[model samples]
Target chain A: MTLTHLNARGEAHMVDVADKQETRREARARGSVHMQAATLALLSEGGLPKGDVLATARIAGIQAAKRTHELIPLCHALALSKVTIEFTLDEAESCVHVEAFCRLNGRTGVEMEALTAVSVACLTLYDMCKAVDKGMTIDGVRLEEKRGGRSGDWSREPMPEPAAATSRDPSAEAEKPAEAEKSAAISPTSGVKIQFLAELRERFETAECVLEWARLPSRDIAGVKLALINQDPKYKALLNQRVLCARNEAMSQNEAAVAPGDEIAFFPPVTGG
Target chain B: MKIVINVQQDAFNTEVEQARLTEGRSDIGAIVSFTGWVRDFNERPDVSALTLEHFPGMTEKALHVIAREAGERWALQGATIIHRVGRLEPGDAIVLVMTASAHRRAAFEACDFIMDYLKTRAPFWKKEHTDSGSYWVSERQSDREAASRWEHS
Candidate 1:
């Protein structure tokens, strides 16, 4: 028979670490916040109003590391040595990459602390910008690396340092159907999803003016306007050179034809989440 | 060995867990598991279902790390966890935490520890889906009160 403070019930308790040795332990984890290229661009450009998204998120991550146990029951409290969060701009997809590394000297590893840091950082980003970008998502928050404990310095990936991406080259790969599919599969609102419908509307409506495409370096640039009135001799030379990525699903054979005086609205697809 | 993380999933099982936590032991004294199910009854009645989203990678890592921490603090032979994701309904197993130890004290300690971990650390955002529309879960006094106890401990 089990004689203990808890039975089969939902209760709160801290993990007892009175007997565990205090050793130097550290945990490094990485998590990402995937946003629309437009959203990302806005973030990078400091268009977000919550006052420095990265700065606030970084501070939030550190605070989260220190409060891991308070937020999680059964987690033994320990002295955290260091908690650092970094952000990088991925120009390709227009997403902010948040990475957190947490260190501690205690009986157990700091994996939770590190993970907590990343999660809070992402949440902080969401909170700061949800007013403008509610569809933002946090994904792939995994242990990039860790050290100490019986497992002995284990990690699923390299000891990733903190960074983000901002505008890669506009390569032909941007136009590949497969790349668009892959981006949608990972997180449906990036890359081509953000711009497909707008492109279709512009093309079919014979809409005048420059059209911003979701081409490479997408996060670095906004939608361009095309002037349909002119032969657009310049745009003719740039055909298929660029594309738009929006926060929606990929277009299925983008085709649009609009009669005179027709108005078209392009919006991001509604996500299940 | 019992693990708990804050996230949402449809189902979790215990029978299948016994094999996982006690795989090595005929010597195990007792096994304890605490499974938390999504109750159909909330403060509101019209709640048809709920969907939970989380900082994916961070959520799992937080759970694993919490579970491992509990195991180290309390002597446990083994632990297992099952956390669900995506849309879920009432009566769904949101979390499953089980612990095995040489004696009941350790098992019980580990089990309690895991539940506590679930309440506080996991980065899951809860949305209550009702006939009206989707609403974010407001802060609950009970959860804060429960978690508050550990803050001082």
Candidate 2:
């Protein structure tokens, strides 16, 4: 694709949008700042040294969005009808999610403005929290979506998991450290464990029971249920009710295969919101 | 896809949950959310309180499965499912489901799909306290049918 903001000589220049139609356009951008859990708690409780980190960040984001054109060399200045900067505090990850929205009826897209807002917001957060958490990291800054303009609407697709760091070099694996820290979700050689949950536990009176792999009649959930019933007739209650089964934390049908050291759970249908 | 699943006893802020899905990303063109609240009348009008019980580890796993399936079905950028357990009074929020995508339809449908599957597949039992007594809430046939429709579509 040809560059829109460049002349044939390749010198950067803003494209003339005078003839472009005035249409409603909207854009959103997001980013995050990771910090210590204690830092986040202090910020949330208004105990941060900066007095109010989120409020300051929000104001900074809005101001940055309005002045995006001034900061960027070739961006066209358009009056944004609305600019909203929002934040979400994540306790488990000790991070703050920042989002910005820019909307207007104009010729140019506001994606850059929204992105600028989020970037400034994250930077402001870092500035306010740096006193307490010097190692905070600001990342994941990107445009979430845009609507209107001649190119039409666009949105980001789901991101794929990051590629393994050492996988790029095939020889690195041979020299890598021992694999003792491998995934603990699935362990080999241990016998299958059956777990009863909620109402099922109340009826069965046992939270969990293990079965030897070699003694099982089969390796499927149906077979496991039969074996469990043989051990205790009360287990037959599960068969009578609309019991649901899960193999290794995923919903599984009765015929789903199971291996040694796998976790199996049975419960009734959910009535949650 | 970014998926966040939380099963806790504390209340969740809808706006914060929405921000969790949309923040720091501009590629989402549309977002749809559904919040379920504890109504004063469910099976009876004089209900005073409700208690939600769920399988601890399995609850989060089941919600993850549901949210992941929604992400697979739709071109979703992010999804969140927060379900509250423990005793809840009337007007308390019980669950929140949010889906972000490029188009309104995908976001709307994914949110609906998550709620439908969550109601039937998630291992949560609700017991409502009425004027007469408290009883374990029964699964609705409509919820099952709602979830089944997605399979054919």
TM-score of chain B of 2: 0.97
TM-score of 2: 0.52
Tell me the spans in candidate 2 whose CA falls farther than 4 Å from its real position: A1-191, A212-215
Cα distance off (Å), candidate 2, residue B131: 4.8
Clashes of 2: 12
Specify the CAPRI tier of model 2. acceptable
Tens-digit lDDT track for model 1 on A15-122?
456787777787777888888787775575566677577788899899888888899776767688777787867757567778777777788879889899999999
Which predicted model would earn the best TM-score? 2
Q: Which stretches of candidate 1 lie over 4 Å from their true place?
A: A1-273, B1-10
